[model samples]
Target: MAAASLNVENVTGLLQDCLSKLGFEVYPLKVGWYNSVLSPSLRLPFPDDSLAVVVLSTPAMFEQAFLPFMEQRGCQGLSDPIDQCVKHCATSAVSQCFPGQNVDVRYDYELLPSRKPKFLAQTAAHVSGAAFYYQQSDVTDQPWAEKKMFGVCVHPRFGGWFAIRALLVFEDVVVGSEVVQPVPPDCVPTREGRIQLLESFNFHWQDWSYRNIICPVQTYSQKQRDYFSARPAERFALLRTWGFLPKEDHQPDISSDAQSEMITHG
Candidate 1:
Protein backbone atom coordinates (compact mmCIF):
# COMPACT_ATOMS: atom_id res chain seq x y z
CA MET A 1 0.00 0.00 0.00
CA ALA A 2 2.27 2.77 -1.20
CA ALA A 3 1.01 6.23 -0.32
CA ALA A 4 1.10 7.35 -3.94
CA SER A 5 -0.93 4.34 -5.01
CA LEU A 6 -3.50 4.77 -2.26
CA ASN A 7 -7.05 5.17 -3.60
CA VAL A 8 -9.20 7.55 -1.60
CA GLU A 9 -12.35 5.54 -2.11
CA ASN A 10 -10.66 2.27 -1.28
CA VAL A 11 -8.94 3.64 1.79
CA THR A 12 -12.12 5.30 3.01
CA GLY A 13 -14.01 2.06 2.57
CA LEU A 14 -11.33 0.14 4.41
CA LEU A 15 -11.46 2.60 7.30
CA GLN A 16 -15.22 2.43 7.52
CA ASP A 17 -15.09 -1.35 7.56
CA CYS A 18 -12.37 -1.39 10.20
CA LEU A 19 -14.27 1.06 12.40
CA SER A 20 -17.38 -1.07 12.04
CA LYS A 21 -15.49 -4.16 13.18
CA LEU A 22 -14.43 -2.23 16.27
CA GLY A 23 -18.04 -1.29 17.10
CA PHE A 24 -17.89 2.28 15.82
CA GLU A 25 -20.46 3.99 13.64
CA VAL A 26 -18.43 5.84 10.99
CA TYR A 27 -19.59 9.25 9.88
CA PRO A 28 -17.08 10.92 7.60
CA LEU A 29 -17.65 14.61 8.18
CA LYS A 30 -14.98 16.13 5.94
CA VAL A 31 -12.53 15.16 3.23
CA GLY A 32 -9.97 17.69 2.04
CA TRP A 33 -6.33 18.62 1.46
CA TYR A 34 -4.34 20.87 3.74
CA ASN A 35 -1.18 22.97 3.57
CA SER A 36 0.30 23.10 7.05
CA VAL A 37 2.19 26.29 6.25
CA LEU A 38 -1.15 28.03 5.71
CA SER A 39 -2.10 27.48 9.35
CA PRO A 40 0.63 28.31 11.85
CA SER A 41 -1.47 27.44 14.88
CA LEU A 42 -1.85 23.77 13.95
CA ARG A 43 1.20 21.65 14.80
CA LEU A 44 0.70 18.82 12.38
CA PRO A 45 3.22 16.02 11.89
CA PHE A 46 2.58 15.94 8.16
CA PRO A 47 3.77 18.54 5.62
CA ASP A 48 1.92 20.76 3.14
CA ASP A 49 -0.66 19.44 0.66
CA SER A 50 -1.38 16.35 2.70
CA LEU A 51 -4.68 14.57 2.15
CA ALA A 52 -6.72 14.61 5.36
CA VAL A 53 -9.88 12.83 6.39
CA VAL A 54 -11.83 13.64 9.53
CA VAL A 55 -14.38 11.22 10.96
CA LEU A 56 -17.20 11.84 13.39
CA SER A 57 -17.69 8.43 14.96
CA THR A 58 -19.50 7.00 17.97
CA PRO A 59 -19.28 3.69 19.79
CA ALA A 60 -22.12 1.67 18.30
CA MET A 61 -23.44 0.65 21.67
CA PHE A 62 -27.03 0.22 20.59
CA GLU A 63 -26.04 -2.08 17.76
CA GLN A 64 -26.30 -5.79 18.54
CA ALA A 65 -22.66 -6.32 17.50
CA PHE A 66 -21.00 -4.18 20.21
CA LEU A 67 -22.02 -5.99 23.40
CA PRO A 68 -21.17 -9.40 21.98
CA PHE A 69 -17.79 -8.14 20.80
CA MET A 70 -17.10 -6.67 24.23
CA GLU A 71 -18.08 -9.89 25.95
CA GLN A 72 -15.76 -11.79 23.66
CA ARG A 73 -12.82 -9.52 24.43
CA GLY A 74 -13.21 -9.78 28.24
CA CYS A 75 -13.00 -6.47 30.11
CA GLN A 76 -10.42 -4.06 31.49
CA GLY A 77 -10.65 -0.32 32.24
CA LEU A 78 -9.13 3.06 31.29
CA SER A 79 -9.75 6.72 32.03
CA ASP A 80 -11.05 7.49 28.56
CA PRO A 81 -12.15 3.96 27.82
CA ILE A 82 -14.07 4.31 24.58
CA ASP A 83 -11.52 6.64 23.00
CA GLN A 84 -8.69 4.33 23.97
CA CYS A 85 -10.49 1.33 22.53
CA VAL A 86 -11.16 3.18 19.30
CA LYS A 87 -7.52 4.29 19.13
CA HIS A 88 -6.30 0.73 19.48
CA CYS A 89 -8.71 -0.60 16.88
CA ALA A 90 -7.98 2.24 14.44
CA THR A 91 -4.22 1.86 14.79
CA SER A 92 -4.42 -1.86 14.18
CA ALA A 93 -6.66 -1.44 11.15
CA VAL A 94 -4.49 1.26 9.58
CA SER A 95 -1.31 -0.68 10.23
CA GLN A 96 -2.72 -3.84 8.68
CA CYS A 97 -4.10 -2.01 5.63
CA PHE A 98 -1.08 0.23 4.92
CA PRO A 99 1.79 -1.68 6.47
CA GLY A 100 4.70 0.63 5.62
CA GLN A 101 2.89 3.59 4.15
CA ASN A 102 3.63 7.16 5.13
CA VAL A 103 0.51 7.72 7.21
CA ASP A 104 -0.16 9.27 10.59
CA VAL A 105 -2.92 7.88 12.81
CA ARG A 106 -4.16 10.35 15.39
CA TYR A 107 -6.85 10.07 18.07
CA ASP A 108 -9.05 12.47 20.03
CA TYR A 109 -7.21 11.61 23.26
CA GLU A 110 -3.43 11.31 23.60
CA LEU A 111 -2.64 7.60 23.87
CA LEU A 112 1.07 8.03 24.28
CA PRO A 113 1.58 10.57 27.06
CA SER A 114 5.16 11.20 25.97
CA ARG A 115 3.98 12.32 22.53
CA LYS A 116 1.08 14.60 23.32
CA PRO A 117 0.02 16.07 19.99
CA LYS A 118 -2.98 18.36 19.70
CA PHE A 119 -5.10 16.23 17.36
CA LEU A 120 -8.25 18.36 17.66
CA ALA A 121 -6.45 21.54 16.62
CA GLN A 122 -4.73 19.70 13.79
CA THR A 123 -8.05 18.30 12.55
CA ALA A 124 -9.70 21.72 12.71
CA ALA A 125 -6.82 23.30 10.78
CA HIS A 126 -6.80 20.58 8.17
CA VAL A 127 -10.51 20.96 7.56
CA SER A 128 -10.76 24.74 7.88
CA GLY A 129 -7.19 26.07 7.21
CA ALA A 130 -7.67 28.75 9.85
CA ALA A 131 -6.54 29.23 13.43
CA PHE A 132 -8.81 26.90 15.44
CA TYR A 133 -11.14 28.66 17.80
CA TYR A 134 -13.15 27.03 20.60
CA GLN A 135 -15.78 29.72 20.74
CA GLN A 136 -18.46 29.14 18.08
CA SER A 137 -19.03 32.88 17.70
CA ASP A 138 -15.40 33.53 16.77
CA VAL A 139 -15.55 31.10 13.84
CA THR A 140 -19.31 31.13 13.20
CA ASP A 141 -18.67 33.82 10.58
CA GLN A 142 -15.91 31.66 9.10
CA PRO A 143 -17.40 29.08 6.76
CA TRP A 144 -14.50 26.67 6.98
CA ALA A 145 -14.80 26.35 10.72
CA GLU A 146 -18.40 25.24 10.77
CA LYS A 147 -19.45 22.32 13.06
CA LYS A 148 -16.91 23.44 15.62
CA MET A 149 -18.10 24.04 19.16
CA PHE A 150 -16.08 25.27 22.11
CA GLY A 151 -12.77 23.36 21.80
CA VAL A 152 -14.49 20.30 20.28
CA CYS A 153 -16.45 19.87 17.08
CA VAL A 154 -19.99 18.45 17.16
CA HIS A 155 -21.80 16.23 14.71
CA PRO A 156 -25.29 17.11 13.54
CA ARG A 157 -26.49 13.59 14.17
CA PHE A 158 -24.30 12.38 17.01
CA GLY A 159 -24.31 15.61 18.97
CA GLY A 160 -21.87 15.20 21.92
CA TRP A 161 -22.29 11.42 21.94
CA PHE A 162 -19.72 10.92 19.19
CA ALA A 163 -15.98 11.40 19.25
CA ILE A 164 -13.57 12.84 16.67
CA ARG A 165 -11.99 9.43 16.34
CA ALA A 166 -9.25 9.66 13.76
CA LEU A 167 -7.39 11.95 11.37
CA LEU A 168 -5.59 10.14 8.56
CA VAL A 169 -2.83 12.16 6.89
CA PHE A 170 -1.64 10.73 3.60
CA GLU A 171 1.44 12.53 2.43
CA ASP A 172 1.25 11.28 -1.16
CA VAL A 173 -2.40 12.09 -1.87
CA VAL A 174 -3.63 15.64 -2.54
CA VAL A 175 -7.34 16.35 -2.87
CA GLY A 176 -8.35 19.04 -5.40
CA SER A 177 -10.99 20.72 -3.28
CA GLU A 178 -9.75 23.53 -1.04
CA VAL A 179 -13.06 25.20 -0.27
CA VAL A 180 -14.66 24.36 3.09
CA GLN A 181 -18.41 24.04 3.26
CA PRO A 182 -20.70 24.71 6.20
CA VAL A 183 -22.02 21.68 8.02
CA PRO A 184 -25.76 21.10 8.29
CA PRO A 185 -27.59 23.43 10.72
CA ASP A 186 -28.71 20.49 12.84
CA CYS A 187 -26.39 21.33 15.75
CA VAL A 188 -26.16 25.08 15.32
CA PRO A 189 -27.04 27.23 18.34
CA THR A 190 -30.04 29.52 18.34
CA ARG A 191 -30.17 33.24 19.27
CA GLU A 192 -32.06 32.49 22.49
CA GLY A 193 -28.81 32.69 24.59
CA ARG A 194 -25.22 31.61 23.88
CA ILE A 195 -24.10 31.51 27.53
CA GLN A 196 -27.02 29.33 28.49
CA LEU A 197 -26.13 26.94 25.71
CA LEU A 198 -22.54 26.59 26.87
CA GLU A 199 -23.55 26.17 30.49
CA SER A 200 -25.79 23.21 29.73
CA PHE A 201 -23.55 21.65 27.09
CA ASN A 202 -21.68 19.01 29.09
CA PHE A 203 -19.19 16.81 27.26
CA HIS A 204 -17.65 15.29 30.36
CA TRP A 205 -19.39 12.46 32.14
CA GLN A 206 -19.27 14.28 35.46
CA ASP A 207 -22.64 15.90 34.86
CA TRP A 208 -23.87 14.35 31.64
CA SER A 209 -27.14 15.56 30.18
CA TYR A 210 -28.78 15.29 26.78
CA ARG A 211 -30.73 18.53 26.99
CA ASN A 212 -27.91 20.76 25.76
CA ILE A 213 -27.97 22.92 22.64
CA ILE A 214 -26.11 20.34 20.59
CA CYS A 215 -28.13 17.40 21.93
CA PRO A 216 -31.49 16.92 20.26
CA VAL A 217 -33.07 13.58 21.14
CA GLN A 218 -34.01 13.16 17.52
CA THR A 219 -30.32 13.31 16.54
CA TYR A 220 -29.12 11.09 19.37
CA SER A 221 -31.29 8.03 19.65
CA GLN A 222 -33.21 7.04 22.77
CA LYS A 223 -30.86 4.10 23.23
CA GLN A 224 -27.90 6.44 23.59
CA ARG A 225 -29.73 8.41 26.24
CA ASP A 226 -30.34 5.22 28.21
CA TYR A 227 -26.66 4.28 27.98
CA PHE A 228 -25.61 7.65 29.36
CA SER A 229 -28.25 7.54 32.04
CA ALA A 230 -26.69 4.47 33.60
CA ARG A 231 -24.94 4.92 36.96
CA PRO A 232 -21.21 5.60 36.68
CA ALA A 233 -20.28 2.43 38.54
CA GLU A 234 -22.61 0.36 36.40
CA ARG A 235 -21.21 1.90 33.22
CA PHE A 236 -17.64 1.33 34.38
CA ALA A 237 -18.40 -2.25 35.26
CA LEU A 238 -19.99 -2.88 31.89
CA LEU A 239 -17.01 -1.35 30.08
CA ARG A 240 -14.56 -3.29 32.20
CA THR A 241 -16.41 -6.58 31.83
CA TRP A 242 -16.41 -6.04 28.08
CA GLY A 243 -12.67 -5.18 27.92
CA PHE A 244 -13.23 -1.52 27.12
CA LEU A 245 -11.17 -0.20 30.01
CA PRO A 246 -7.50 0.61 29.60
CA LYS A 247 -5.06 -1.22 31.83
CA GLU A 248 -5.01 0.38 35.26
CA ASP A 249 -1.23 0.78 35.18
CA HIS A 250 -1.25 2.17 31.66
CA GLN A 251 -3.33 5.21 32.58
CA PRO A 252 -1.25 8.42 32.51
CA ASP A 253 -1.26 10.84 35.38
CA ILE A 254 -1.72 14.36 34.07
CA SER A 255 0.34 16.97 35.83
CA SER A 256 -1.21 20.31 36.73
CA ASP A 257 0.55 22.00 33.82
CA ALA A 258 -0.48 19.32 31.34
CA GLN A 259 -4.05 19.40 32.64
CA SER A 260 -4.12 23.16 32.22
CA GLU A 261 -2.64 22.86 28.75
CA MET A 262 -5.38 20.42 27.67
CA ILE A 263 -8.04 22.72 29.13
CA THR A 264 -6.55 25.80 27.47
CA HIS A 265 -6.36 24.27 24.00
CA GLY A 266 -8.82 21.35 24.13
Candidate 2:
Protein backbone atom coordinates (compact mmCIF):
# COMPACT_ATOMS: atom_id res chain seq x y z
CA MET A 1 0.00 0.00 0.00
CA ALA A 2 0.94 3.63 -0.27
CA ALA A 3 2.61 5.32 2.64
CA ALA A 4 1.42 8.48 4.42
CA SER A 5 1.73 11.78 2.60
CA LEU A 6 5.40 12.71 2.39
CA ASN A 7 7.39 15.80 1.62
CA VAL A 8 9.10 15.93 -1.77
CA GLU A 9 12.19 17.56 -0.35
CA ASN A 10 12.50 14.89 2.33
CA VAL A 11 12.15 12.14 -0.23
CA THR A 12 14.34 13.70 -2.92
CA GLY A 13 17.05 14.69 -0.46
CA LEU A 14 16.95 11.26 1.12
CA LEU A 15 17.41 9.48 -2.21
CA GLN A 16 20.21 11.83 -3.32
CA ASP A 17 22.09 11.37 -0.05
CA CYS A 18 21.82 7.59 -0.35
CA LEU A 19 22.54 7.29 -4.08
CA SER A 20 25.12 10.00 -4.90
CA LYS A 21 27.93 8.29 -2.94
CA LEU A 22 27.38 5.26 -5.22
CA GLY A 23 27.70 7.28 -8.48
CA PHE A 24 24.00 7.71 -9.26
CA GLU A 25 22.00 10.95 -9.46
CA VAL A 26 18.32 11.46 -8.62
CA TYR A 27 15.99 14.27 -9.70
CA PRO A 28 12.44 14.71 -8.45
CA LEU A 29 9.46 15.80 -10.59
CA LYS A 30 5.71 15.64 -10.43
CA VAL A 31 4.13 13.02 -12.65
CA GLY A 32 2.23 15.76 -14.48
CA TRP A 33 5.42 17.30 -15.77
CA TYR A 34 6.18 14.11 -17.69
CA ASN A 35 2.59 13.54 -18.81
CA SER A 36 2.26 17.03 -20.24
CA VAL A 37 4.90 16.33 -22.90
CA LEU A 38 3.69 12.83 -23.91
CA SER A 39 0.73 11.55 -25.83
CA PRO A 40 -2.31 10.41 -23.85
CA SER A 41 -1.63 6.72 -24.39
CA LEU A 42 1.94 7.08 -23.17
CA ARG A 43 1.07 8.99 -20.03
CA LEU A 44 1.82 7.46 -16.66
CA PRO A 45 -1.37 6.50 -14.82
CA PHE A 46 -1.01 8.66 -11.77
CA PRO A 47 -2.23 11.89 -10.26
CA ASP A 48 -0.61 15.14 -11.35
CA ASP A 49 0.84 15.74 -7.93
CA SER A 50 2.37 12.29 -7.54
CA LEU A 51 6.04 12.45 -6.71
CA ALA A 52 8.47 10.77 -9.08
CA VAL A 53 12.24 10.59 -9.20
CA VAL A 54 14.37 9.80 -12.22
CA VAL A 55 17.67 7.98 -11.60
CA LEU A 56 20.76 8.40 -13.75
CA SER A 57 24.03 6.46 -13.76
CA THR A 58 27.19 8.49 -14.17
CA PRO A 59 30.49 7.00 -15.45
CA ALA A 60 31.44 6.06 -11.92
CA MET A 61 28.48 3.67 -11.79
CA PHE A 62 30.56 0.98 -13.47
CA GLU A 63 33.25 0.92 -10.79
CA GLN A 64 31.21 2.13 -7.81
CA ALA A 65 28.18 -0.13 -8.28
CA PHE A 66 28.52 -2.80 -10.97
CA LEU A 67 32.00 -4.10 -10.14
CA PRO A 68 31.19 -4.45 -6.46
CA PHE A 69 27.82 -6.01 -7.24
CA MET A 70 29.44 -8.61 -9.50
CA GLU A 71 32.08 -9.42 -6.91
CA GLN A 72 29.45 -9.86 -4.19
CA ARG A 73 26.49 -11.48 -6.00
CA GLY A 74 27.51 -12.68 -9.45
CA CYS A 75 24.96 -13.01 -12.28
CA GLN A 76 22.10 -15.12 -10.94
CA GLY A 77 19.76 -15.62 -13.91
CA LEU A 78 19.31 -15.29 -17.68
CA SER A 79 19.30 -11.52 -17.79
CA ASP A 80 21.64 -8.67 -18.63
CA PRO A 81 24.23 -8.34 -15.85
CA ILE A 82 24.23 -4.54 -16.01
CA ASP A 83 20.44 -4.50 -15.74
CA GLN A 84 20.65 -6.82 -12.77
CA CYS A 85 23.16 -4.63 -10.96
CA VAL A 86 21.18 -1.42 -11.50
CA LYS A 87 18.00 -3.10 -10.31
CA HIS A 88 19.65 -4.47 -7.19
CA CYS A 89 21.07 -1.08 -6.26
CA ALA A 90 17.82 0.79 -6.94
CA THR A 91 15.69 -1.79 -5.15
CA SER A 92 17.94 -1.84 -2.10
CA ALA A 93 17.94 1.93 -1.93
CA VAL A 94 14.13 2.19 -1.98
CA SER A 95 13.67 -0.57 0.56
CA GLN A 96 16.21 0.86 3.01
CA CYS A 97 15.23 4.47 2.45
CA PHE A 98 11.47 4.05 2.52
CA PRO A 99 10.43 0.70 3.93
CA GLY A 100 6.86 -0.48 3.21
CA GLN A 101 6.17 2.36 0.80
CA ASN A 102 4.46 1.82 -2.54
CA VAL A 103 6.99 3.26 -4.95
CA ASP A 104 6.46 2.01 -8.50
CA VAL A 105 9.98 1.30 -9.68
CA ARG A 106 10.42 1.13 -13.44
CA TYR A 107 13.76 0.22 -14.96
CA ASP A 108 14.79 1.56 -18.36
CA TYR A 109 15.30 -2.01 -19.54
CA GLU A 110 11.81 -3.14 -18.57
CA LEU A 111 9.05 -3.53 -21.19
CA LEU A 112 5.31 -3.46 -20.77
CA PRO A 113 2.92 -6.16 -22.03
CA SER A 114 2.67 -4.14 -25.24
CA ARG A 115 6.52 -4.19 -25.44
CA LYS A 116 6.75 -0.42 -25.02
CA PRO A 117 9.13 0.76 -22.32
CA LYS A 118 7.38 0.94 -18.94
CA PHE A 119 8.39 4.59 -18.79
CA LEU A 120 10.00 6.71 -21.51
CA ALA A 121 13.59 7.10 -20.28
CA GLN A 122 14.50 10.29 -22.13
CA THR A 123 11.13 11.91 -21.36
CA ALA A 124 11.56 11.25 -17.66
CA ALA A 125 15.09 12.58 -17.71
CA HIS A 126 14.00 15.69 -19.56
CA VAL A 127 11.02 16.43 -17.31
CA SER A 128 13.07 15.88 -14.17
CA GLY A 129 15.67 18.41 -15.34
CA ALA A 130 18.35 15.73 -15.14
CA ALA A 131 19.29 16.01 -18.81
CA PHE A 132 18.30 17.92 -21.94
CA TYR A 133 16.64 15.56 -24.43
CA TYR A 134 17.49 16.78 -27.92
CA GLN A 135 15.14 15.51 -30.60
CA GLN A 136 14.58 15.89 -34.34
CA SER A 137 11.65 18.18 -33.51
CA ASP A 138 13.99 20.45 -31.57
CA VAL A 139 15.99 21.24 -34.71
CA THR A 140 14.25 23.58 -37.16
CA ASP A 141 14.65 22.88 -40.90
CA GLN A 142 15.34 19.26 -40.09
CA PRO A 143 17.90 17.30 -42.07
CA TRP A 144 16.31 13.86 -41.63
CA ALA A 145 13.08 14.67 -43.44
CA GLU A 146 10.20 12.14 -43.11
CA LYS A 147 12.35 9.88 -40.96
CA LYS A 148 11.68 9.35 -37.27
CA MET A 149 14.86 10.16 -35.41
CA PHE A 150 14.87 9.02 -31.81
CA GLY A 151 15.74 11.53 -29.12
CA VAL A 152 18.66 11.20 -26.70
CA CYS A 153 19.28 13.01 -23.41
CA VAL A 154 22.53 14.83 -22.75
CA HIS A 155 23.51 15.57 -19.17
CA PRO A 156 24.75 19.09 -18.44
CA ARG A 157 27.81 17.82 -16.67
CA PHE A 158 28.16 14.31 -18.04
CA GLY A 159 26.98 15.18 -21.56
CA GLY A 160 26.12 11.87 -23.22
CA TRP A 161 28.30 9.93 -20.80
CA PHE A 162 25.40 9.07 -18.47
CA ALA A 163 22.46 6.68 -18.71
CA ILE A 164 18.90 7.08 -17.50
CA ARG A 165 18.59 4.07 -15.24
CA ALA A 166 15.10 4.08 -13.66
CA LEU A 167 12.05 5.99 -12.45
CA LEU A 168 10.73 5.78 -8.92
CA VAL A 169 7.09 6.96 -8.67
CA PHE A 170 6.11 7.58 -5.10
CA GLU A 171 2.50 6.46 -5.36
CA ASP A 172 1.27 7.98 -2.14
CA VAL A 173 3.54 10.96 -1.88
CA VAL A 174 2.03 14.09 -3.35
CA VAL A 175 3.36 17.61 -3.75
CA GLY A 176 1.71 21.01 -4.09
CA SER A 177 2.34 23.92 -6.46
CA GLU A 178 5.46 24.79 -4.50
CA VAL A 179 7.21 21.95 -6.37
CA VAL A 180 7.95 23.89 -9.56
CA GLN A 181 9.57 22.05 -12.41
CA PRO A 182 13.13 23.01 -13.35
CA VAL A 183 14.33 23.41 -16.94
CA PRO A 184 17.10 21.10 -18.09
CA PRO A 185 20.22 22.88 -19.32
CA ASP A 186 20.32 23.61 -23.03
CA CYS A 187 23.73 22.05 -23.56
CA VAL A 188 23.52 22.07 -27.37
CA PRO A 189 21.85 25.42 -28.05
CA THR A 190 22.68 26.03 -31.70
CA ARG A 191 20.63 24.57 -34.58
CA GLU A 192 23.81 23.48 -36.35
CA GLY A 193 25.01 21.75 -33.19
CA ARG A 194 21.66 19.98 -32.73
CA ILE A 195 21.73 18.74 -36.31
CA GLN A 196 25.22 17.39 -35.90
CA LEU A 197 24.34 15.76 -32.57
CA LEU A 198 21.23 14.08 -34.00
CA GLU A 199 23.05 12.84 -37.08
CA SER A 200 25.89 11.33 -35.06
CA PHE A 201 23.45 9.58 -32.72
CA ASN A 202 21.22 8.34 -35.53
CA PHE A 203 23.65 7.40 -38.29
CA HIS A 204 26.97 6.83 -36.54
CA TRP A 205 25.99 5.87 -33.01
CA GLN A 206 28.37 2.93 -33.19
CA ASP A 207 31.32 5.36 -33.31
CA TRP A 208 30.03 7.15 -30.13
CA SER A 209 30.97 10.66 -31.36
CA TYR A 210 27.60 12.00 -30.23
CA ARG A 211 28.69 11.42 -26.66
CA ASN A 212 31.42 14.03 -27.02
CA ILE A 213 29.23 16.82 -28.45
CA ILE A 214 30.09 18.77 -25.33
CA CYS A 215 33.06 18.46 -23.02
CA PRO A 216 32.01 15.99 -20.35
CA VAL A 217 33.29 16.32 -16.80
CA GLN A 218 33.89 12.56 -16.68
CA THR A 219 33.46 9.72 -19.14
CA TYR A 220 33.41 5.97 -19.26
CA SER A 221 36.80 4.41 -18.67
CA GLN A 222 38.55 2.27 -21.25
CA LYS A 223 37.60 -0.83 -19.26
CA GLN A 224 33.95 0.22 -19.29
CA ARG A 225 34.11 1.03 -23.00
CA ASP A 226 35.61 -2.39 -23.71
CA TYR A 227 32.73 -4.06 -21.93
CA PHE A 228 29.96 -2.05 -23.67
CA SER A 229 31.73 -2.39 -27.04
CA ALA A 230 31.05 -6.13 -27.19
CA ARG A 231 27.74 -7.54 -28.44
CA PRO A 232 25.26 -8.27 -25.67
CA ALA A 233 25.14 -11.99 -26.47
CA GLU A 234 28.92 -12.22 -26.26
CA ARG A 235 28.98 -10.52 -22.84
CA PHE A 236 29.07 -13.79 -20.97
CA ALA A 237 32.48 -14.55 -22.44
CA LEU A 238 33.62 -11.03 -21.70
CA LEU A 239 32.49 -11.35 -18.09
CA ARG A 240 34.42 -14.56 -17.79
CA THR A 241 37.55 -12.70 -18.89
CA TRP A 242 36.87 -10.26 -16.02
CA GLY A 243 36.85 -13.20 -13.54
CA PHE A 244 33.07 -13.43 -13.32
CA LEU A 245 31.26 -16.66 -14.22
CA PRO A 246 27.66 -17.63 -14.96
CA LYS A 247 26.01 -20.68 -13.43
CA GLU A 248 26.70 -23.87 -15.30
CA ASP A 249 23.07 -25.04 -15.32
CA HIS A 250 21.84 -21.91 -17.06
CA GLN A 251 22.80 -21.17 -20.64
CA PRO A 252 24.93 -18.05 -20.94
CA ASP A 253 22.11 -16.18 -22.63
CA ILE A 254 20.49 -12.75 -22.62
CA SER A 255 17.06 -12.03 -24.11
CA SER A 256 16.78 -10.50 -27.58
CA ASP A 257 14.67 -7.72 -26.12
CA ALA A 258 17.48 -6.91 -23.70
CA GLN A 259 20.03 -7.12 -26.48
CA SER A 260 18.08 -4.66 -28.68
CA GLU A 261 17.70 -2.25 -25.80
CA MET A 262 21.44 -2.28 -25.16
CA ILE A 263 22.41 -1.93 -28.80
CA THR A 264 19.95 0.90 -29.46
CA HIS A 265 21.08 2.91 -26.43
CA GLY A 266 23.22 0.64 -24.24
The number of the candidate with the highest lDDT is: 2
The TM-scores of all predictions, comma-separated, are 0.61, 0.94
Name model 2 segments beyond 4 Å from true: 1-5, 246-251, 255-260, 263-265
* Candidate 2 TM-score over all chains jointly: 0.94
Which residues of candidate 1, in runs, are more than 4 Å off?
21-41, 59-69, 75-80, 111-116, 121-152, 177-186, 202-207, 210-266
Q: Write the per-residue lDDT of candidate 1 for residues 53-165, one digit (tens) a residue.
A: 55444535335344554555533443434444455576777788778877666666554554655465334532442212234453334433335454434444444554455
Clashing pairs in 2: none
Which digits, one per residue and each the tens of the lDDT, describe model 2 over residues 48-111? 8999999999999999988898889998876888999989999999998899898999998888
lDDT of each: 0.48, 0.86
